[model samples]
Target: MPVLNPDIARAFDEIADLLEIEDANPFRVRAYRTAARLVLGLSSDLKTMVEAGEDLTELPGIGEDLAKKIIEIVTTGHCSFLEKLEKQTPPALTELLKVPGLGPKRVKALWHELDVETVDQLTRAAREGRIRSVPGFGEKTEARILEALQAQIAAVPRFPIAVAAPYAAALVRYLQNVPGVRRVVVAGSFRRGRDTVGDLDILATVAADSPIMERFTAYEDVAEVFSQGTTRATVILRNKLQVDLRAVDESAYGAALHYFTGSKSHNIAIRRMGQDMGLKVNEYGLFRGKERIAGDTEESVYAAVGLPYIEPELRENRGEIQAARAGHLPKLVAMGDLRGDLHAHSKASDGHHSMRDMAAAARAAGLEYLAITEHSRHLTIAHGLDPVRLRRQMDEIDALNTELDGITLLKGIEVDILEDGSLDLPDSILSDLELVVAAVHYRFDLPRGKQTARILKAMDSPHFTILAHPSGRLIGSREPMDVDMPRIIRHARERGCFLEINAQPERLDLVDIHARTAKEEGVLLAVNSDAHSIHDFDNLRFGLQQAQRGWLEMKDVLNTRTLKELRPLLAATMSR
Candidate 1:
């Protein structure tokens, strides 16, 4: 199988993690980390680039040595250097880092002091009070680790939707190329646009005598085939993502797709509705007393239940069926509905691309305007802007705006909201920008009441235009801070400010539930890409899906308005 960009990136990350655990050279460790980020952020496939004989060294942050490693990974589907390092280090140490609050230092400490090399060992130590005995760990730390371990044990391993995308696309394309395949669709949480997917459910229609099952099992990426039959198969990919494929007759394609693409609760609800209508719904077809009625298309399936087609994203049984019946279903916001992106970054801060490059990329992405919201002085790691630097960048944007035609750049700052609810930058400086995207970057573990007040106070600032990633959660890596989301949503409405659905795959904050609350409270949400690189604008697609899943319409999205329409609304928020 071809090594996809994500696969290559993961290998680099593992190497970095293992090296860090071994206390290897800081520069060497940093190089692999940077390379991993560069690969993940690239819009093109590294395998294709390698096949075209492109000079990988020409890519920023990738040197000759890394270039050779990329080639080896792409051509052979494995990295010799990573394998050697894994042999040297306790490979499980890398997995230990996945525990929240456990970094390389702690992993190393645990391994050396407690002889703990695995989660199971660590869990046993924590439970036995051995973890607190480690020099740096205390009773509270040990308690938190134990709690995290319990949650981890109970949770099913799932990949972020973005992480699963390339694999699914590759598999679907492969299946579609099968000689006898007539139709191919991936269903389940993936089709529903869930934040993370536990597994892939694929449905296909093939001609009689097709050898699709054989071809699927023989695919290069298949690490193991658990089961195989004439019409169905299950396999685990090399990356450990499980996949189940079902080959259905052309007449039953829709029924199979609907059946497999489901939240079990949603499917049960539909089946109950079918039962009331004197109908039977199954993977084969929707029937009335054994006479097949509707199964040719999803639309027909919905029609059989006397309802209009419900989008996969709305099939979570979250009042969508009722809305569909009443003809009140929202016209979910589409990617094309956005005219401007109100949150983005440039190289002036932590972003990778220059202002001009980011502006050009946004224009190419069909955006009429893009906000350059660089980080402020509080975020030193990002080389965030001080007043002097911000002013210089604003002047630069003014010059670039004069030269640009298709796109306009809005001056903005992602100012930090301090623990005391004060803005990182003074109002004098923040007032100069077209937007102020306030964010909470530290103290994520504040008491619920304090956290809620902190955000509410920040929103009280006249210059606060939007709260970026309101929940401050990193999907899998970090849990959201304890805060009153309903109160925050209500405060935003009263304060005439907005919240953001930050589009970074790992930081898809303002999750669907909060987004729905914001929409219901008459508070518009900005589905911003939070783009750090030019290619990062692509993340807006995921943001749109998040918004759609929240039942947001174009009207509920702040950026869907024309730039002319947006300016007044923004100005109103910044007014005293």
Candidate 2:
């Protein structure tokens, strides 16, 4: 019955959605939405703080009323306000908001006009050509809705890596503390460092008498126990994340881990190699005619098949086996390799922290330099900087750099790439900064050719250093913009510009495949924590995960180089 941060956030988000659909006050709806974001972004556990009798109102955007609501939900596992809102409006209407082009207004229209309550109902209306009859919804909008519905139906729900980490780490810690438990490891996509995971596959080794299954099924977060056996248990957490736990003997531990931490194709390929060698491979062990051979360690399993142990992130059967055979597996980039982050924001823009606070946090994170890339003037909602303001900020950074120790601030702007591909700020202003992190802030639905051209043209700018979040994807919520990434990578290579592997959980842009493609094309990537707050510097880990999955080595990363070595490379991007 624990009310986790995500749980509270979801409640507030739902309340906001329902209220918006009901035509509630805009300020009230916005307050709930902002509260949800503040709760979700908190680094500490609200439940633990609540149990410790800490004041929840200390959290930004959480007023006295919201603080009481947080305490109530943590104590009772429900929020009365959200429950009442759900009663007033069909909760399913919130699902309509998830459709790509449908906003709260569109959802309200559909609900009030056609009585559409679910995706199925919406689909029916779309198919019957009835959605077009709704005011503000035309044939094109209806068609787009149908397309989005089909995509949603075909998609499997995935938890963002950041969202899943806490649950997985807590479970591992819990099991590790159990009596007679020898080892516990989270496997599957999590172990592979995937950007999103469907579920958790946990493996543990314990003494013969250990009551591991019972302990797992009794965990406080367990919403339902699907099945339980002496050595295995399957349960769904209150957050709807499914977890499967298996206890294996020490002898089969590595094999079991390998089997479960699989890209199924990778396992099949290894099993096929085992077959070629007159051996059988499975979760239990690698056997040569039932005379158990390698199973105690992952190295032994791979050695039995004449290959070195491949890193989990690269175990996708995507040339990994071949690379392993040829002794060519990459020394993937590690978190320690980064020297600086080139994309960040502060109170000068949409960011919550001051420039000094963000720099100090970066220094604490072992970074020697960090860029302060506030948004340019076009992003008015973020209070983006005009040329004069940017100049003033540049002077401030210069003063801070002289006063600070151990860290340096690089002046930069996340200059919006206009629809026609021009930088938001004039070159006269851009020339003053250390770097320019160009990005697309709007026009997400441009045709593939147009989008590609738009980005390509932006890169031609003398000051354009890195292409931030090249695809502009927001994980499950927003599909990546249509653009030719391969062409973009090639252009970057020719222009000596770099692309960013933005570390934000929502937009782990320049995803695994694209990162790898860039590496192969000889274009370096900056795995940047596009941090808006000091806590956001920790997001670099997720970025590193994405880079690792892309087969990136330290040399393939632009930010891994020391400042002495990096400045020259960055200078190459500027026009003479």
Candidate 3:
């Protein structure tokens, strides 16, 4: 089996987690965590590079020691260091670290003091009122742990789109290279642009003698082949992602794609329409009383039912069919529609790249403008800038704007929204920047009313332009804050401020439903990369996916406007 980048990254992360739990050297633990992030963020395939004899140590944050481990995992699919660490610390203890309020120190306390090794053990202790007696855990913390444990138990495992992308793209590319294979498309939530996917449903059309199923089952990343047939196969990747592949002939390709690219409710609704038209629609083909009609093209499939082609992102059965019938479906915003990204960071903060490098990358990505929104001073862990440092960065941006050719850098700060709903920086400093992206980096467990009111109060400030990662969610890791989203959207509408659909895969906040709500409330949304490094710009595609699912039109996205148009809109948010 081939070790993918994510597979290696997971191993490194697990090692870091176990090390931290063991109270090992802080720097050593950080090195492993950083190495894991570096691996995960690379745009290229680490395993392929290792196979090709590339110097793995040349990669940032990867030392000679880590490089050897990378080669070990790539060559043998296991790391001895991680294996040893798992033996020293219970591997299940890592799950306890995922509980919201449980940090490494607290997890250590639970392990040594309470003998809690897993979430179940921790939950049992918490329920028995034993957790509160631990060193740092109070009654409130125990209750929160119990609640988090229950929520985790009830939630289905879903992979973030970014985590699934490498596997999907690799599989598609691999299948496309197979002799006689005509088309390979990943359907299901992935194609529909959902933030998280349960699994990949891959559809392909190939010649009868293609042996596609056999090829798929033999792929380097396949950990196990659940089943295999001439036309269909199910396999799990090494990273634990299940992929189901189905092959059809060209005649049924479109119908098969439509059937597989489904929101189940949407498919049921469309099939009902087919029944009304005296026809039947399925993976085979569309038929009218035993006579094959349309199935060669998705457009033809829609036309057979007297409807226009609906974009897959809009096929959520959320008034999409009705909108299509009325010809009111939005012209969804595409990747090229974005003119700039408004949230990013640089070396002055916790970002890995320099400002100029980030700007050059944005330009390379075809963006006309980019904002450097470094964290404000309150976020000291990021070495966030004070007013003095911020002013200096602003000057740097101004100078670079003059020297740069195509891309212009905007001066901005991701100011923290304090516990009392106040801005982190003074208006005197904030007013000097091109944009003020307010975020809630702390106090995530605030009650819904308080959190909503806190955000609204921050928006009341004259300088607040956008709400960064409006929900503060980290996919499977963190739950979305309990704020009332509709109220926040309405407030943004009234305040003339914008909400962010953060592109970071882990925090695809202002998710599809909230983005749609903002659009319906006549509020524009900004789909920003929130990039900390050049590679992070790629995250914008995920943000675009979320926006597309929200039925966002080009006009509904704030950053899609030219710099001239965007300037006045952002300025308008500050006038009040």
Candidate 4:
């Protein structure tokens, strides 16, 4: 029911795309991103003012065009430039830009050199030994590029809770073993239950020893140590994510935990408050009452200043403090309440395994069941299957169902929602699918009104079950599809359709606030991982975190049923 300020995430996406699109000044684009980070930290809605016709650009860091876009979204629910920009960009090329470390500069170079517009072509070029021969590329770089490409292709776009949970547990496991370690806990976005993890933070109390920090970094799993010190250490795990470990003394453990387990800005505001009270705050004890009255303990630390424990997602240095001060902090969802995964893929589309492989993974995670929604014919690069292939996959599911044990599989399709919001597949074809995860894969650069209408039209589909990845977000790469999400969520609820909380790291599409809004509207959510491989099914952890961060619960979700029960939910639409 609240309007979100998408500026920071928006700016990061656009600036990266501007780089890949090879449009605009690199410096100016960089300004948008720098501004985005700062703005994302601010909790107020730029839209409310924009809707009042105020020039939001007067706010430091926002430019005129950016202000205009804010106005457009607030007023009409879309951005013109983002829409135009997307229209000009080939969706295939946009997906290509998502390869980590491969910016628009490199993408443009590849496009210019090999005339390869898609990942598949680029992969072929990299593998057959053609890409490295080009200027600005060589053997080692080529190998790394190919490896990244292989990862992008071979891996699922998302993973589930079952896969990431163990790693989170293992990462937590390692920190607990540190000598002198006391009360170490996982923090950052993960603790808040996000849909994906970029890094892990562990807060603990040690004797504050150099030897302990050294031992912590010297652990066998430590692939590379970025920094090491008496009370702090940063290292990379086998996964490329960064992990920051902080240590404090026993007396100050809780204070240190609150400080180090911070979303940074959350800590900063507390320090500022401490400063206002003539106290100094750090990973050490809260230096108030001069005798350092506040000893270690997050509650004691917050209680020292009179506040409740803040959720990490809400801790983005936003209005959380003011809200907490007023006893109005937003309630966030927790992972234990999530039921099942909705959007997943198998070898059926561009996935690594069969439907049975995916369902088994879900069951193992104690999930009720899963919806195997493979890509439709529109996504040629993903090898979206045709009608015949679709039928064959259904038969496969039926065969597996007869022999099934616990979790069941629902037959679904990630159908393409065209620029006009029409189903890319015919009604007859759509009629057979148990669930439809429709998405916009093309013409993303349309005007605000059109983009909103485009999506709304798709939701109007009598056969449509869920809107997949409502925002079409690709973290660090692409901007959201220019559509009015709150409006669409409201519309979907009215239409008896559900929205997807895509668990993919790049496209946690139904982000926290949006998911919360859907819940308020009483719309059911399909928390899907969009997994293309067995590993991706594990992204459900990230998805659950995200959904919880938005304050979603098990009852708000639809796919938490056993596969047999879920099938009827979808098939009932046909009967209607």
**Candidate 3 residues 60-177, lDDT tens each?**
6678999999999988989999999988889999988888788889988898999999888988998899999987889998898899889889877889888898889999999999
Q: Order the candidates by TM-score, highest first.
A: 1, 2, 3, 4
lDDT string for model 2 (1-576, tens) is 756777888889898899888888988887898777667656788889999999877565578999999998999998998888888889999988999999989999898899999989999999999999988989999999999899889989989888888789889988898888999999999999999999999999999999889999999999999999999999999888999999999998889999999999999999999999999999999999979998988888999999998999999999999999999999999999999999999989878778999899899999999999999999997789999999999999999999889999999999999999999999999998889999998999999999999999999998999999999998877889999999999999999999999998889888999999999999999999998777788889999999999999999999999999999988888754
lDDT of 1 by residue, 337-408 (tens): 999899988878877778898899899899999999999999987788999999999999999999998999
Report the poorest 10 consecutive residues by lDDT, candidate 3: 34-43
lDDT of 1 at 126: 96
lDDT values for all models: 0.91, 0.91, 0.90, 0.70
RMSD of 4: 17.8
lDDT of 4 by residue, 327-438 (tens): 9775654555455677888766666566777788777767766777888898886789778888888888788888878766777788898877898777877787777789
Which residue pairs collide, candidate 1?
Answer: 188-261
Scored by lDDT, model 4 comes in at 0.70
Index of the highest-lDDT prediction: 2
- The alpha-carbon lDDT assigned to residue 574 of candidate 4 equals 48
Among residues 3 or more apart in sequence or in different chains, the pairs in candidate 2 whose N, CA or C atoms overlap within 3 Å are none
